[model samples]
Target: MTGLDPELADATGKMLTQAVAEVVGDDPPVEVEESVVLGNAAEVLLERSCGAELLVVGSRGHGGFSGALLGSVGQHCVQHARCPVVVVRGSVS
Candidate 1:
């Protein structure tokens, strides 16, 4: 969650988790972590990516050419990730 207020972020995160649980019926419990950041999201994702086994991200973020297969974030992570990276691209059905 990106918010100026940490309290608000925390509340929103909890609410989101609960809502996800409602939609994720019969699935095993999932672990979730929320970070309140005011900086670049790509940087934050990279910083937390040091020892991950796999880094999966969208092929394109909310920027640049809409027809491009990869965005700045995907390119940066693909180049900097310690492990393998997967960039998923799909049409909105």
Candidate 2:
């Protein structure tokens, strides 16, 4: 969970949908579901990872040391997740 305010969370969900659409285009080859949960991000993600084939997470999220190789959440998930974890690092624009 991101712990975002309700208003921001709603906007984030919409943005996530839009981003996925932009990436996959009209007919995505794979199914995708976007959601935002409220709680500790790592713990929530870990819980959901139980039956998942893969768990993808960002190298660093909204707030973190920019120079770090991985953020706390990503690091935690990488260390403890039950499934394969993919840590995607965003390019700096």
Candidate 3:
């Protein structure tokens, strides 16, 4: 949806499903649902955060400074989300 190529979107969806399955395994402790929504990433996440228990985001630190801890979207969510927010970063090897 939203300008994404059909094949790419299908592949992305499948990949996300597989990743979630791998994480949750056969019997997840909590309910799990997978969906794909195309829009401004931050705006979409904020809208969906209305009643979420927690919000988790990944930051590649690809913003202005390479050594920065959070990207713009993660920072925005941390400041504005109604629920608790967690920012996950790549492991320091």
Number of the predicted model whose lDDT against the real structure is largest: 2
User: What value does the lDDT take at residue 4 in candidate 1?
Assistant: 65
Q: Which ten residues in a row have the lowest lDDT in candidate 1?
A: 28-37
- Model 2 over residues 34-78: C-alpha lDDT tens digits? 677888888989999998888888885455565477888888999
By descending lDDT, how would the candidates be arranged?
Answer: 2, 3, 1
**Better candidate number, 1 or 3, judged by lDDT:** 3
Error of 2 at 66 (Å): 13
lDDT of 3 by residue, 1-93 (tens): 778889989999999899889878989998776767788888988887898887888887555774466877888888899889888776557
> What's the TM-score of each model vs. the native?
0.58, 0.75, 0.75
Using TM-score as the yardstick, the better of models 1 and 2 is 2
**In model 3, what lDDT does residue 5 have?**
88
| Position 73, candidate 2: lDDT | 89
Q: Write the per-residue lDDT of candidate 1 for residues 1-93, one digit (tens) a residue.
A: 444687877776788678556645547465534344566867877887787666767775444665466888788888887778878775566
Task: Write out the backbone clash pairs for model 2.
Answer: none
